[model samples]
Target: MGPIATTFPVLGVAAWSSTGKTTLLVELLPRLRAAGLEVGVIKHAHHDFDIDKPGKDSYRLREAGAAPTLVASARRYALMQETPNQDEPDLVHLLSLMEPHAPDLVIVEGFKQWPIAKLVLYRDDIGDPGILACENVQAVALKGAAPDTLEASIVRLDLDNIDAIAHWILQWCAAFPDHER
Candidate 1:
């Protein structure tokens, strides 16, 4: 019972609320891209969010009962599906949808409780805590140093060092082969 096993390389950026998880990913993504890696991101929203506007045709069609509404343009497309029944969205299913795109790495933001191999971001000034998902946390990003009580097995990372974090992620992606599991 290690971290959640996946066929493709997946790394989760997990953190408590208001821990700047998205901000770190925003900065980390371009570095990964500059290293010539194709990356896919799946972000979980705890609050309700709306992608489509009120008067758009896609919105109208979706309101008229399209379960999965896909709008494709020449360059890009978006698929919106409504799930009112599920307690929690399935991370595996989301990963499957992105599998066909063949990204070199998939970074999952949020969904920290899903038992995936993840780097936990913690700010000592945030004051809530210094940890999340103890069993699955492979690394931890902190503003300063790791707490003395933290396990030696967990890699301590400097949150301000974007280059170092990018290097670590690249190394992680290399661990997974370019074939399916």
Candidate 2:
């Protein structure tokens, strides 16, 4: 697929470890939903995790050499796939899978290595915390003062103001349905 993300905008929330990325997302998701937009979230996990417990049928099945064990219910479902010897998950593939759902926006958390339009959150309390030089960072949200070294081109946002942040993201989605390079 040639530049698949160009067809639909994928916004990313990037921050250093313990920078409250999840806390922001948890609050922001509802606001986005209240604004009458369907949002999809893709979170990148750094550690190994298992949603199903050992005694659970799905977990037992997966442990019994099943490559993927899908657990479903009337309300929700989860698909667990094992990738032995795999180093990293292919984000593009995940995007392709979610494309059918046709969400108004897709917000990605973590996966800082990708060249996507992202809002980087920062806190001055973190030891030597500074803005990362991610190529596609559209905005730098800060709890305190924006670093003097920050470029004038990048928009500065208030990290503690969820409504303002949400509004900025909403405007960004409207301006660039297909964003960044």
Candidate 3:
């Protein structure tokens, strides 16, 4: 595992595309927050994605060569940075960007090959090779019965049990140093 600055505890949910990663997060985030934890999220996208709409001022400003464009409003704000020719920043670099938010935990989505501890989500129909052999997989959240090949030492979780998963995440966060928490 590469050195990700341990400013905050980070737990990752890794899975192949269309394996319900985002769906699980949508359910899990609120529960984590309800438990009095401030959460930040970093998602890895396989293709170009735009949060700003065409003809929007922020989009226009970025197009006009603003390396990073910060747009703010009373309700919320966002910082969008352009990395024209640069390779995608690694997990450590991305985590550094969230330091200003000072969240208690950060849930990272995707970045399957990154060495951070992760809960590997699986479903039989995805046709992708299982990630159990991957380094740093701390647990597996399987849909339906636990696979016969699954290792007994690795924690097993039910993919459909959002409450249990959220509780497990909270417990995992507790294991991090109190200073980071």
Candidate 4:
């Protein structure tokens, strides 16, 4: 219900299937850490999931009508619950839970529909022009020439050049530290 205290700015990495988004995230995260920035990651799931199983005590407790049931141990914890509404929680709500140890940057691996600044992954192999239709993309990681119709704000880069991509993200982070706050 209140604002969460956080240090790292939030960013989104978006791309179509096989566009190399995950590859980029894997490479960039450690590099960002090497630059002394603590990084947190959020991956959006497209399917139904169960972190708690039916036979588990936590699952039974929830079935018995516990709201927001939490099962914890020294090693890990799990909270299982259902929201009252059909709408999913937005980015802000999700990030608030990471507070008290918010990393220097939060890299979101999906949610391409949102307004946050993003690096759009593109591949000529995907053969789809969805990237051309995306709005608010801060840059493009692609294998070929970026379409002239693409927004002027989108900085284009060679997808194979991990160093260039990493440097571009760091620069973006430096320029928008306040966004992380």
**Highest lDDT model number:** 3
Query: Taking the candidates one at a time, how many backbone clashes does each contain?
Result: 0, 0, 0, 2
lDDT of 3 by residue, 38-124 (tens): 999999987888899989989999999997899999999988888768677577888988898889999999887887889889886
- lDDT per residue as tens, model 2, 43-112: 9998898788989888889999887777899999888999878797778877776788887788989878
Model 3 spans with C-alpha error above 4 angstroms:
179-181
User: The CA-based lDDT of model 4 is what?
Assistant: 0.77
lDDT of 3 at 171: 86
lDDT of 4 by residue, 1-181 (tens): 3323455677889888767777788888888888878888888776677788888888998888999999999998877667657476577767876666657778888877776778888876685767656656888887887766777767888899998988988888888647542
* 1 or 3, greater by lDDT: 3
The better candidate by TM-score, 1 or 4, is 1
lDDT of each: 0.83, 0.82, 0.84, 0.77
Models sorted by lDDT, best on top: 3, 1, 2, 4
lDDT score, candidate 1, position 49: 87
The C-alpha stretches of model 2 lying farther than 4 A from their native spots are: 1-6, 127-130, 178-181
TM-score of each model, in listed order = 0.91, 0.91, 0.92, 0.81
Best of the two (2, 4) by TM-score = 2
TM-score of 3: 0.92
Looking at model 2, the pairs that clash are: none
